[model samples]
Target: MAEFESPIVMPKLITFLSSLLQRAAESNDINQSHQSQKISVFHGLSRPSISIQSYLERIFKYASCSPSCYIVAYVYLDRFTQRQPALPINSFNVHRLLITSVMIAAKFMDDLYYNNACYAQVGGISTTEMNFLEVDFLFGLGFNLNVTPTTFYKYCSYLERGMMMLQPQINMSESSLYMGISSKLHLSFNEDESSQSHHQQQQLAV
Candidate 1:
């Protein structure tokens, strides 16, 4: 895996996967498709939705980091969809997919305190099952796990300070609003930069 010194530039991967997730969510209600196979690992189990939510909450609580880990996991899920068009669009395996993605993301973003067994315990899956799912997910994601965000909270803080300095007369409420808007705009700029970088890399590769 390439060590991403900069952040991961993968908006194409994110957009593609978001579409897949939407399609998967939709398919659960309507027609059944082969894309369902990719998600079948999530089926015939306990309360999958509740389980997924719990897993996410635990990740945030224990990871004690920015939502960057969550975002990276989501990007992994999305990237998987791009590679495997036959993935199932159902809730059956959504949690499994989410856990697998988070596991990979955690490993890449931070120290590996939690192993496959730990994830299995938290996600309510067997050790063997977790291992299998991890392998499957890794293969789908092309084993590329390095993902960081350029628009970190530090950047937001700097911009907020600049805003405050520039507009000293602004009241607290207005300053908060300005900070919020600036943060959002910064994130959008980061996304655009990542997209442009990816495009350039692709062009160079060709």
Candidate 2:
């Protein structure tokens, strides 16, 4: 059975971030080419660091988890990266890593148990791949599982309340406005000042 890991220590996190930044700078100079090259650059730099953050953001956007849970997940990912220097940080692998980390973290903080099959389906990886990665991830994290963040429940509750408050204002059937908000939340495209102003005008009309 998989177990929950302890929260990552601080000094290790700092070291990991430092290394990640250095790698990101090096990746920026490399010319983009094939998928492998892109993966190499991301693994060496951006994806490792950003994946945790992005994953946390995505989970919080949908789940009622606290920012603290996300923070703990970030810390775990960072520490694990520091210790497992060989782990890939490319787009594909980074996503896999993030999913694995979050699953472990949820168990630690929320007392939730996530199955490999769910992770495989969402991550588009085979169950064998997920199992392999999970083992590698567990080893990287030092088997110190015992994380219990204080904020996840509270944040989730707050989000629920906020959504409830907004429900009356949102017409679920209206695709355009719903799409606009969703786009903004996902940072899919840039919204300039004029766009923001226009959105405000539209809101006032409603």
Candidate number with greatest lDDT:
1
User: Each model's number of backbone clashes?
Assistant: 9, 10
Cα lDDT tens digits for candidate 2, 109-144: 554545777666655558887787777778877974
Candidate 2: Cα lDDT at 36: 30
- Can you give the lDDT of residue 121 in candidate 1? 79
lDDT of 1 by residue, 1-206 (tens): 12111122122222333444445656653554432443345444543556434555555445443334544565566566666656643556666787778777766665434788888877767999889888888887687554334433333233334344544464333224223333222122334434433322221111
Worst 10 residues of 1 by lDDT: 1-10
lDDT of 1: 0.50
Give, for candidate 2, the lowest lDDT window spanning 10 residues: 1-10
Per-model C-alpha RMSD: 11.3, 16.7
